[model samples]
Target: MLQACLNGGRMRDFHPALPFTATEIASDAALAVAAGARELHIHPRGPDGAETLEPEHIAETLQAVRSAVPGIPVGLSTHWRIPPGGLSRQEPIRRWTTLPDYVSINLIEEDAEDMIALVLGKGIGVEAGLWSVSDAQRFVGLKDAAKCLRVLIEINEQDIDEGLRAAAGIQAVLRQAGSTLPILMHGDEASVWPIYSEAMARGFDSRIGLEDGNLLPSGRMAGDNAELIRAALALAPR
Candidate 1:
């Protein structure tokens, strides 16, 4: 599946086309889906244009995007930075009047176990974000690793050689752990297409968008998320 990560832990200064509001997200989602994105990853923002976990913001974002692009599964990045961790981070999920189809949580973060249990306990699917071999090992130790919706093998390494090496390291860990969970592998700015091609060649799910990069595979600045998705689909191995 090609998931479109619309906007990540970033603000408007990153990209003017970045979608923060529900309206913008929904519109971009429609175009991206038409361009071949099967799943949506977004960072719903507040009135002040900052990412917010407030139930109201989540509810509105989910409702608007889901309503606009009916049938597309929409998820959000549950970053600890939003509320700066502790009970504050977990409280909103507990108080959510509206829930997303799923959420991607950074497994490397503190309190991740508690957060995973909470989201799972709520019956919402969890996408574990594993950044390194150690993170993959940590996930393997979980008896419930198989229950996760998917494991995101996020290679943040920008250098192509190092990024692929990181991917290999984590894959080795997951193999040793006997994890059968689905894998969504991807990278950022400089390594996006290389990693996407790797994921495609290996038949694993991959994601792309402004959050990960604003440039197209040709090194051109993308006009919007749709352009990126189109480029990503075109880059797939035949």
Candidate 2:
């Protein structure tokens, strides 16, 4: 299913039009859903414009989006304000609630197992986020693969050509795990369109939004998340 990454890992300094408040995010979520997004991925931000894992912030964001687009599955990122060694802390995970349909956990951080366990115990779906092939392999190696909930393999542009190669590696890992779990692939920044098109060609579910890139396929600034979704749909193989 196509998802809309409303916002994640973004700051006001990165893009002047990036959505920061619940109101703005709600508007974007509605537009994206109307544009064919079945799921919504969002990262709640605090008043200072920094990513926040606070329960209240997440609640407000979820509330707004749910009010705007009822019944659309929503997911939140657990990579909030994550520092080099901050994943071990229980504070962030403690704040997560079932309000969001899914919560993404980056494998790069420490104590990933514990965090995943907590999320599962809370009955929340998990989106295993892989930034590199190594991370994908590690995820595949994890025991009880069924607990992952859902998986989203993220290919960052900084990895360059390795991005597509990493996607292939992830497919291999999924094969070895013997899991037919739903997988979605997408890229960040200027590389989003290329990888998105490639994802569709490979017959993979995917997503797009300001979180991935603020520019449209035409290289112009996208006015909103709907614009990006429309661009992605246009690029999808007919």
Give the TM-scores of the predictions, in the order they appear.
0.97, 0.91
Question: In order, what lDDT does every prediction score?
Answer: 0.89, 0.79
In terms of TM-score, which candidate is strongest? 1
Error in Å for residue 143 of model 2: 2.5
Backbone clashes in model 1, listed as residue pairs: none
Mind sharing the TM-score for model 2? 0.91
What would the TM-score be for candidate 1 when compared with the true structure?
0.97
User: What tens digits encode model 1's per-residue C-alpha lDDT throughout 135-212?
Assistant: 888888876678899999999998999999999999999888878889999999899989999999899999999999
Q: After superposition, how far is residue 44 of candidate 1 from its true place, in Å?
A: 0.6
